[model samples]
Each structure stands twice: as C-alpha cells, then as structure tokens.
Target: MSNTPLVQMIGIEKHFGGVRAVDHVSLDLYPGEVVGVLGHNGAGKSCLMRILAGAMLPNEGEIRVGGKTVTFADPNDAREAGIETIYQTLALADHLDAPSNLFLGRELKTRFGNLDDARMLEESRKVLARLNPNFKNLSDPVSSLSGGQRQVIAIARAIYFDTRVLIMDEPTAALGPSETAMVSDLIRQLRSEGIGILLVSHDMHDVFDLCDRVVVMNKGRLVGAHGIDEVTKDDVLSLIVKGELPADWSARNLEAAQ
Candidate 1:
C-alpha cells in the first residue's frame, strides 16, 4: 500500500429529517485495493457510498481525492474527479447497443463534431474483449445480452475511462454462480490494473474472494476495517450483526488454517 490514499472520508455525517442516516465515519480507499463495504440494511452502508458518489451530500465531512480535500457538488463533480459508480440497477439503456451503452454520456466525436458510431463500436469491442471475450457484438442492443454480459458493459465503461476510484453497489446481488464468477474475474482484473475500488456487498463470498480489505458499518457509524487475511467469515458475520470485532477475533490472530 502507498502512504497516500486515493480517496479518504473523514468524520462524514448526514441525515434525513430527524433520522441520522450516517454518523461520523472515517475510511480510506487505496490504489490497487478493493475495500468491501459490508452491513445489513439501514446500517448506513449505501448512504456513506452515496455521499462519496455524490448521489447524496453529507452535511458535514471531508473528502480527499489524491491528497487534496474536496467537496463533490454533485455526481458530475465526482465523475469529473475520475470517480465512477455502477449502481445495482446496472443503469444501461435497454434500447442502446453495447457500444452506445459503453459511451453513453461520453462519446467519441468525428471531426465534423458528430457522433462517431464506427469508432465507438470498435473501442467498445476492444475493452470488452479484454474482460469478456465471449461478450456478444457491440452492435446488439443491451437488452439481448445476458446478465453477465450487461455487467461486462458496465464495468468496461468504467475501465475504459480509467476511473481512479470505482464504487459498486451490490455488484453481484442477483446472479447465478457462473455470472458471479465472471464478475469476480472482472474485479480481479481491475485490481491488477491498480484502480482503487469500493465494493458494497452483503455476500461474504463476494467480499472474501474479491476484497483486499473489509470495512463494516452499523447504525451509520464505522464499526471496523480489517485486512482480509486478518479476519474470517465468522468474524465478519459477527461484525455485520453486532457492529464490532467478535470476541474471538483477536488483533494478533494468525489463523494457521488458511
């Protein structure tokens, strides 16, 4: 890990009406590392991520990207700073083809300042080929692609832009084992490319298999952050339910079982 963090959240707090959705919380995401955000519903996992993604604003806090503290005025602000979020809905235009989806908001333009359909198609194919070779043609509408194919588009879109920090909300929430494996490989590829990632997921398998570290939350507060090898499934499960290290989860614990 580097001494400088890619993104850092310090004492973040937010609320909806009288309900405090996120209490003061601090966390850091490093380059080339995937940090899993794990918590039950209403544990403030999504709210915290929303603040960082600019889907929601925090009334009080500090966000630093690449060592400079900054505030995201909105989603565009975050996106301009090289932060891209892939929400659970996948958010792809069903009628659009893979290339159209890949370059949805951002597109390649011809010298005449018009959409360059051919170039977009070629680039989309290149990016997808790096991640999923079997991904169908870029000219085909996303609606015709399978779940895994759609996910490849979403991830390929983010990677093509070289997003510095990526946030995914429940990426594998609803997928078959095969689909899950495909997504998991994509994540490993992302990590290999040295992009920092924040993964919000409830699935232990997703976390253990793909994350370098795990950050847990409960009642809008950060409960703990531990290296993946430093914690076990049972310990992580306990933190999700009880909001702290399990009694048996010793800081010095070096399980020989692994």
Candidate 2:
C-alpha cells in the first residue's frame, strides 16, 4: 500500500434535524487497498460515505484528495475529483443499451452536435471488454441483462472516466453465489489497477474475503478499525453491537506487538 492516502475524511460529522446521523469520524483509503465499512442500519456508515461521495454534505469536516483539501457542492464535483460512487441500485438506465447507459449524462457528441452513437458504442465495447470479456449484449437494454452483467456496466461507467476512488454500497447484496464471485473478481481487478475502494457491506464473508481492513460504526460513531488479519469476526461483532473493542485489544498494545 502507498504511504500517502488516496482519500481522507477528517473529523466528518453529519446531522439530520436533532439526530446526529454521523458523529466525528475520520477514515483513509489507500491506493490498491479495500477498506470495508461495516455497520448496522442507521449506524451512520452510509452517511459518512455519502459525505465523501458528495451526495450529502457534512456538518463539519474536511476532505482531502491527493494530499490537497477539496470541497464538493454535489456529486459532479466528486466525479471531477476522480471519485465515483456505485450505489446498491447500480443506477443504470434500464431502458438504454450498454453504450447508451455507459455515457448517459456525459455523452459523446459529433462535431455537428448529434449524439455520436457509433463512437459511443465503440468506446463502450473497449471498456467492457477490459472489465468483462464475455459481455456481448451491447445492443440490448440493460434491464434484460443479468445482475452481474448490470454491475459490470455500472463499474465500467465509473472507471471509464478515470475514477481513482470508488465508493461501493452493498455491491454484492442480492447476488447469487456465482454473481457475487464475479463482482469480487472485479473488485480485485480494480484494486490491482491501484483504485482505492471504500466498500460498505453487511456480509461478513464478503468483508473478510475482499477487505484489507475493516472499520465498525455504531450510533454514528466509529467504534474501531482493524486490519483483517489482526481481528476476528467475533471481535468485530462486539464492536458493532456494543461500540467497544475487545478488552485485550488496544492501539498501543497492537502497535507494540507489531
């Protein structure tokens, strides 16, 4: 992993009315690493990630990308900063074909200003070929495609725009074993390409299998963060449920032992 973080959220906090949806929290994602954010419903993990994705603003906090502080008024600003978010919905246009969906809002236009269908199709083919070689339904509407295939489209759209930081929310949820494995393989490929990923997932197996590190949150506060190899599933569960670490586990002891 790189010594310098690819993305950092420092002292992030979010509130909805009188409720503190996200308490002061700080997290970092490094290139070529996957950090899993695990929390129960209403635990504020999604709120924290939304702040980073620019879908929601933090009440107080700062975000740094590539070592420079930045602000995002909306998701477009985040995309401009090389950050892309893949929500659980995948957010593809069901009525459109792969090429059309790939460049939905940001379409390639001819010099004459018409939708450059041919060029868009060609570019979509190239990117899909890289992400999923078996993807051949370029002309069919995405609604007819399988779940795994839909995910490929969403991911291709993100990476095609030079995305460096990806926030994936419940990427494998509702996926069958085979489809889940496919998505996992794609995540590994993205990591190999040096794209930092913030994975928000509820599946313990997925977290253990795909994450380099895991952070737990409860009641809008970050309970603890642990390297995958340094913590057990039970330990993580305790943190999630009680917002407390194991009695023997402390940052000082872990550092000294390391």
Candidate 3:
C-alpha cells in the first residue's frame, strides 16, 4: 500500500561470456500496476526478468524494492523480498496435491514441529476459493486439472504468501479464450488487492487488454516504455519488429496524450 514503486531496476547490465544478454535496461513497477514486457526472442526480456526474480545474477546494475537496494544471490532471496515469478513450465510438482503444491518448500509446521496438514489445507482452500471457487478439493493432483486451473493454483500460492510483486511469463499461452478471460479477471482482482505485476507476453491482445504500461525490448536493449493509452497494437508491433519506434508511432504524441 506504499505509493512508492514496488520494484525498480536501473541501468541493468548482464552478460554471458562474450554476449551481452541485458544492455542498460531500466524499469519501474508500482504497486497494483501491471507492466507488460514485449519483445521478440533474444530481446533480453526474459534475461532481465530472470535477474529481477533472482533466478540469475546480474553482472551490473541495482535492484530496489520499496526504495531500498537489494542483492539477491538466488530466487529465494527475491521471494524473501516478496517477489514471485510464475514461469512457463510452472515449477510445480505435478505429482503433488493442491495443498502440497501450495506449500511446497515453505510448509506449515504443526505444534509438534512436523508438517501441519490441517493448517496447510485450510490456508490453501481459503486462498484458492477466493481466487477460484471451482478449486474443489485440496487433495487433487495438478496433472488432472485444466491449464487454467493449474495456473490459478500457482497464482493462489503466490497471493497467499503475501508476495507484493509477481512476474508472470506467458501466463495465457496455452489457454483458451474463456480460460484467458478468467485469468485476466484474476489479474485485475490481484491488482485491486494492491499487488504489482510484471507480465511478459508475446500475445499483443493480452498485452493491450490487461496492461497499464508496455515495455519494448530489442537486441538486449530497452527500446522504450509507454503507457497503454499512448500506443496502439500497431505501434507495439513496430517497436518489436523494427527495434525502433516507427515514424508513425509518435512517442511524443503518445506521451502527451497519455
């Protein structure tokens, strides 16, 4: 509920041997805002987010949460700082049940210092019900659920843990229209709950529909970031395809209008 940015990356630079994976990329995300990252393959969008989520270390640059600098050596560090990344493959254990998956690494402990099945189940049910009422039983395996249901579980897990920021990668990739709409509504619900989100998606429709701002990246460099009200789908396409703002895409117009 702070008015300050939930997360910010300034002049982030990362390299792999001789290759520069991230080049002077900068971004700021505010609480309850959904910032969409758009780029072609190899544009460094994923690499930059990986660094933010603490899945990978950056060669240079600084990350700040609520205006304080942080050094995250691992994803756990980011999680401890209230950041969550929902990847495409969803780091979920398909063999595990809903409650087990919800409390995977950080299990609720009982009074006797063992796994607290009741606490975990109760918490999981409450969170899931708030997010998705159809989350019938906590004993169901994820592999048996639909793609949207599985994603709902992952999102519910993050929300239950009080994560202030979420970085979702291609969340609607394999979902049907109805499923995508459900996820979209859930995203809005999270925003209303005061959680910031960094959404990475190739789907222009999703980006244009759900995001407040759109960031464009190309060849490991940030081309630009614009408010959704300022640009159209055509403008976003131009940025992604040309690696530069098109002549017709007036950033100044977008900026002033926005």
Which of the numbered candidates is closest to the native, going by highest lDDT?
2
Leading candidate by TM-score: 3
User: For all the candidates, what are their Cα RMSDs to the real structure?
Assistant: 2.5, 2.3, 2.2
Q: Which stretches of candidate 1 lie over 4 Å from their true place?
A: 251-258
User: How does candidate 1 fare on TM-score?
Assistant: 0.91
lDDT of 3 by residue, 1-258 (tens): 467999999989999998988998889999889999999989999999899989999988999999999999998899999999888777789989989998988899977899998888898889888767877867978889878778878877777786899999998886778768878998898889888999999999888889999999998999989989888788889889888777866666856766
TM-score of every candidate: 0.91, 0.91, 0.92
- Residue 198 of model 3 has an lDDT of 93
Give per-residue CA lDDT, model 1, range 12-71, as digits (tens): 999899988899999999889999999999999989988998889898999999999988
* Backbone clashes, candidate 1: 0
| CA shift of 144, model 3, Å | 3.5
Candidate numbers, best lDDT first, in rank order: 2, 3, 1
- Tell how far residue 6 is off in model 3, in angstroms: 1.2
lDDT tens digits, residues 1-258, model 2? 989999989999999899999999999999999999998999999888889988998999999999999998898889989999888888988999999999987899999999999999999999999867898999999999998889888878888898899999998785778768877998999999999999999999999999999999999999898899888788888888889877876774568678
